[model samples]
Target: GESVGLHLPTLSVQEGDNSIINCAYSNSASDYFIWYKQESGKGPQFIIDIRSNMDKRQGQRVTVLLNKTVKHLSLQIAATQPGDSAVYFCAENESGGGADGLTFGKGTHLIIQP
Candidate 1:
């Protein structure tokens, strides 16, 4: 897949500060967007999601902004904590249905300095 290119695998951030995670997508036909946060070895938890019809969406201390015009998406975490430190991943689902799996980016490792 085109998304599987060589890329850096981690990110470091300080605690109590805002963290911004960026993602670049290639499929123009993709319509659904999702942001997930995984702590250590647990499964990814859904943080927020936005459809192509909207550009921004918010939930609790997290916000997701989608820019379909440029094929980009971002996840913003406010007041990052040591517990909040984890691997964040942004995913996209194409318009068509079926077992087509989610295309996930390399992910950003959020290191919170407590």
Candidate 2:
């Protein structure tokens, strides 16, 4: 799985509000998914992940939902903060891609408003 990237404008949210980022993929055979957050200069960091067998998984302040029926994925951030400002990416691993098989898709730029 290779990373192919494009972006959809930007999302602006208040510092204490909630944020939901969505991603859609065309691969129906994808069996694993991950949500990553990339700050200005750092590498992509793992935020949350969900396997094809499940629909939703949650982390400290984040949640990942996967809908295989429509090949859609989303990340929900509760109580957004200034630290939440970054580019988020959704990566998919095909059925047989294994642990190292992850392909990144469209990234959403999140801007925190005052």
lDDT score, candidate 2? 0.85
lDDT of 1 by residue, 1-114 (tens): 555111336767788889888888887788888988898779999899899999999999999998888888988899987888888888888867622877888788888887
Q: Kindly list the per-residue Cα lDDT of model 2 for residues 1-114, writing each as its tens digit.
A: 344343464899999999999888776677888999999989999998899999999999998888888778889999999999999999888775444668888689999999
Task: Summing lDDT over every window of 10 consecutive residues in candidate 1, give the lowest-scoring window.
Answer: 1-10
Tell me the whole-model lDDT of each prediction, alpha carbons only.
0.81, 0.85
Q: Estimated TM-score per prediction?
A: 0.88, 0.89
Q: What clash count goes with each model?
A: 0, 0
